[model samples]
Target: MSKVSNRTKIAAALVGVLALAGSNLVAADPLADVQKADGQIHADAAASQKKVDKFFDQAQDMLFEYGTVADERESLKAYNDYVATLVADQEASMKAIQDDINGVDKLRQGVVPLMFKMVEALEQFVALDLPFNTQVRKERVENLKNLLSTAEVTLAEKYRLILDAYSIEREYGNFVAVTTGQLNLDGKDVLVDFFNLGRVALYAQSLDQKTGWMYNPETKGWDTMDESHLRELTKGIRIARKQGALDLFALPIPAAETAK
Candidate 1:
């Protein structure tokens, strides 16, 4: 009986040892599966973080490019505005210049007819004034008439010449003058020295100083001067010619006509 009991105890101890070893192996396999799943999760997270970092860098680059574009647009806009202002100023200046040109044309039209009337009035005044330098004065009037008819001379030039002629006529009334010319007396031409005392009187003396005459504006003729006045007339002629010193002298002048 003792030997049978010993063999059974030994078989039971061997079965317990095999069951404990199987349990340990199953637990170790489960633990190893959990560890592998955790490792895979950590690797996936690291890869996702890398992708996020790349996306953030791309976004930052886009933002910088947008800012650069915006600044360039502003600069271009300011340049365009400046150019537009310059164009506006040029347009205004051109309008003003056109207005000035139009005004000049209108002024030219009015001034032309006025110049003609002024020249005509000058001719009439010269014809009615003192007969001294008559031929030259009439010739000036004739030349002015010819000038007015021509197209070669400018209006301003013609006007300037007419003014110069009027200035010369005005100067004639302020001084004495002497010249030699022919006088028609009693249907004969006589050589004589003509003396003009301003616009006051006109006298003629023969070359020999023997005969003298004064102009009669009332009759438009030469009146024979008396022998008594001949000496004074000779002295007056010499003074006008600047051949003698200035002195008081006598000559007849036509009385001014009263206003009618």
Candidate 2:
């Protein structure tokens, strides 16, 4: 094999190993492993590409039906069912694709830079406090659109990459909470950083009948701020800050703050 192809194969092999190992690669050169994984990730990306295209087709078909039909209860329910089914099927595959992407230690290191970009994109939506998270969803669509420009990856693979990044942020979001009240910055108490994970967690809890925030049209903001939202404003937790400031949870905090 050529040098480039050989490197790529080794990288794919690392991804398979990491997938079996999950996140337990302590004491290993994570960056090296990640680089190796990314090499293969791009290669196997072809397999995932087909699934993503099929999903998009199904989603688009449902959306077309939804748009054409009256927005009635039954019609809306049908549309939602279509989406729920699609999401259900894609969730597992997306998870695997993301794990491989993230497990490629190289990719994890780049997450912070993307997080900054994601944060900036997220800020615009959060600021609007749009109902049903219209802004976030819109941003997500746009982000996926932009990821298409990345060379050497299919559009579907790029989408997989972005989704994986969200998962990474969600899985690691609570690390901010762990530092609340325990860590101090500038002698002030830190509230939990409201990012994708916190938003997802709070949203899930609410969906499950637990307490949660509500969009207040009167205030044009999110209301019913719970401990979960404010528990670590000053935790001085570190995040993807090298990429600059990210508007996580609609809050315009700098990447420097995340680095702390």
Candidate 3:
């Protein structure tokens, strides 16, 4: 009975040891599971931080691109304003040029008719003036008339020529002149030296220097000069020809008619 009791105690001790080992294994499994869950939480936090850093970098790039676009837009606006001002100035200049063109056309129309009347008046004046250089003066008037009808000459040039002709006519009364020509006395052409004293008086002397005649404007005829004036007339002729020194001499001049 004692031996059987000892065997039963040994079996109870073995069962107690197995129960303690199983309880220790259960507690170690729960600690391992908690450590694994903590590691997974740390990994998730690191991934979220990486995603935030990438989003921040993209936002910075977008801000820089927006600023660049704004600056370019302002620059383009300034350039467009400058171009608009230049176009406005060009338009104003074109308008002024057109106005000047219109004014020139009007001036041309008025000037052309006035030139014709001036030419006609000049021809009449030359025909009625003293007969000295008659043919040359008449031909000058005829040339001006022909020039008026010509298409090659410009209006300004024609006006200048006409003014020059008038200027020459005005200068004739300022000086004495002498020319050799024929005189119709007794209906015969006789060679004579003609002397004019500033459009005041005209005289003719034969080549022999023995006789002289005065032109009578009243009758349009030649009248014999007194023999007493022959020497003085010859001296006057010499002075006119620049062959003798300047000196005073007496000659017959036509009397001026009183205004009636």
TM-score of each: 0.62, 0.20, 0.60
lDDT per residue as tens, model 1, 1-260 = 69889899989888889999999999999899999999998999999999999999999999999999999999999999999999999999999999988898797899888878877987888766667999898888789888988899987798898888888888988988899999988999999999987677788999999999887777777788999999999999898888999899887666778100
| 10 residues in a row with least lDDT, candidate 1 | 251-260
Q: For residues 1-260, write the lDDT of model 3, one tens digit per residue.
A: 69889899998899999999999999999999999988888888889889888899898999999899999999999999999999999999999999988898788899888888888997887665556787898899999999999989998899899889888888887878889998888889999999987667778999899999988767767789999999999999999998999999998777776100
Candidate 1 pairs with clashing backbones: none
Cand. 3 Cα-lDDT: 0.86
Model 2 stretches astray by more than 4 angstroms: 1-143, 172-197, 200-219, 222-260
| Candidate lDDT (C-alpha), each | 0.86, 0.52, 0.86
Q: Model 2's lDDT to the true fold? A: 0.52
Single out the weakest 10-residue window by summed lDDT for candidate 3: 251-260
- Give the per-residue lDDT digits (tens) of candidate 2, residues 141-163: 56655665566775446646667
lDDT of 1: 0.86
As a TM-score, model 3 comes out at 0.60
The per-prediction tally of clashing pairs is 0, 14, 0
